[model samples]
Target: MVLLRGFLVLVMFFLLGEALRVLADLPVSGGVLGMVMVTFTLMLRGRVSDELAEASRGLISVLVLLIAPGVVGVFFIVEQFYGQWTTVIVALIAGTLLSVLTTLWLMKKVSESAAGDGRHE
Candidate 1:
């Protein structure tokens, strides 16, 4: 029930963002906007509910599955990169490394902040 509640909250925000995107004819991703709203909402609330935390953890565990579609899409356009495989692979590696490093840094900062608040486990 807790997980369901958390997912519901996330979905509500996503739908609201998608609606706003369509209505505003925005070029940005609705999911990104929705998450920005979530960040603000959580900041205003001053704490994350355990349910949300659990839901996010679960999603992170299954994140690779979520990324599968993008990988498959690239396959469909494989010919487009006929001679640029090295460049593509290098870009992918660089991007992945950068993302991982950024996430690690962010998590470290968040951990420090949470520890200061006695919220770290």
Candidate 2:
């Protein structure tokens, strides 16, 4: 029964992503869309079953290892990156800074809302 529920959750996420892609014209891949859908669902529900939690952890653990082959293939383009290294470095730095700022801003907004609710009570 637990396994069945986990499977159903996965199917629901996949369907949600597909529906979003069709309805909203999102450019992301189905799996990425599915993952975002699942994350949002978990956040909205505020809880996850033990079986599903375990499955998600296992999947996350193996996710990076699964992408290693493609990462290694980047070595083949080492020569191409030599001249473009400066642009790449700048982009990476800028992107990281933007991501950090955005994350902090969101955290601040959520915290302020929570604090306001507490003050009201």
Candidate 3:
């Protein structure tokens, strides 16, 4: 029930985004806009509900699978990327490193905050 509710919330946001995009004639995809909306809502709420957390956890576990199609599609565009392989490789490498560094920094900050909170108790 909790998982269902969480998924419902996500789907509702996506639908709302689709509506808004169609009405506003926005260039961004509905999914991306919906995600942004949900992110802002979550930020305003300050804390995640157990249902949403659980749903997110399940989704994370299968995230690679979810993106598999997009990854596979890249192979179909092999001809288009033939002349720009170097550029593509460099961008991918840089993006991966940046993501890793960002995650590392965030984790360190979070750990430090947790440690500080513990010391105050």
Candidate 4:
């Protein structure tokens, strides 16, 4: 019942986002917009409910299991990726590095600000 309620919250946000997309003719997808809305909601609320946290943890724990079929399917389409493998590899590596660096930089800045470092600004 707790998980159900949490899932319902997610669905509600998604539907809200979809409605806004259709009405406003926004460029972003419903899923992304939904995430943004939920993030703002959580920020305003300042704390996650126990049921939502539990549900989120449960979903994370089985995430790998959920993606297993897609990973397996990649092997079946290996030939399609052969010619473009170099491009794919480079893109993947660059994207990963960029994300890591960006995350580290943001964390540093946040920490500095939290520590009352005027230079952070």
Candidate 5:
């Protein structure tokens, strides 16, 4: 019963995503939109059923395996990236550092705001 409910919820989201895709003519895929819709639903509902939780966990566990083929395909472009390894490494490092700094700054700002509101210890 739980699995059925979870499946129904997933199907509903997929349909909603497809509808959005059709109505808006967005370039994003239906599955990606479905995921976002699911996330929004979960956020609004707060708690999910055990079946849904289990289904999500099981799906996530195998998600990496599903993308393995795409990863393997990267081998075909190895030559194109080989000569640009230095550039790729530098871009990756810079992006990582920027993300980390941005996250830290945002966290500090949030904490300060909370403290100002007397919501902090």
Candidate 6:
């Protein structure tokens, strides 16, 4: 039941995000919006429940498999990218690197701020 509730929370956010996207005609994907909603909720709560953490851990374990279909779909359209291979590859690499760096920086900033709140550095 805990897992079920956790899953429902995720689905609820996703649906809410989709509704907002349709209503606002936003450029971002519903999934991204859902994540933003999740982030906001987590921030407001200030703590993650064990059930949600467990469910999120389970999702992380299968994240690669979740992305496999999209990666495979890219293969089907490989030819379209072939003509702009250089640009495509460069963009992919740059985007991935930027994402990694941004995530790392944010993590460091968050952790440091968290640590600073009542502990000597």
Which regions of candidate 1 are displaced past 4 Å?
A: 83-121
Q: Each candidate: what lDDT?
A: 0.91, 0.85, 0.92, 0.88, 0.86, 0.89
Ranking of all candidate structures by their lDDT, best first: 3, 1, 6, 4, 5, 2
Predicted model with the maximum lDDT: 3
Candidate 6 global TM-score = 0.67
Q: Compared with the true structure, what per-residue lDDT tens digits does model 6 show for residues 28-62?
A: 99989999999999999999898888877888899
RMSD of each: 7.2, 4.6, 5.6, 4.0, 3.2, 5.3
Number of clashing residue pairs in every model? 0, 0, 0, 0, 0, 0
What is the TM-score of candidate 2?
0.59
Best by TM-score: 5
Model 2 C-alpha lDDT per residue in residues 56-94, reported as the tens digit of each score = 666677889999999998889889778898898899999
Least accurate 10 contiguous residues by lDDT in model 5: 2-11
Question: Model 1 residue 16 lDDT?
Answer: 83
Q: After superposition, how far is residue 12 of candidate 4 from its true place, in Å?
A: 1.4
Model 3 clash pairs are none
Decide which is better by TM-score, 1 or 6: 6
Worst 10 residues of 6 by lDDT: 74-83
User: Considering TM-score, which of the candidate structures 1 and 5 is the better prediction for this target?
Assistant: 5
**Each model's TM-score, in the order given?**
0.65, 0.59, 0.63, 0.65, 0.73, 0.67
For 1-121, candidate 4 gives per-residue lDDT tens digits of 9998987887788899999899999999997899899889899999989877777788779999999998999889889777998899999999999999999999999987888866566
- Per-residue alpha-carbon lDDT of candidate 5 for residues 1-121, written as tens digits (9 for 90 to 100): 7767777777788898999999999999888999998888789999777888876777788999999999998879878777898888899999999999999999999999988889544
Residues 6-119 of candidate 1: C-alpha lDDT, one tens digit per residue: 899888989988988999999988898899989999999999999988988898899999999989998788788798998989999999999999999999999989888895
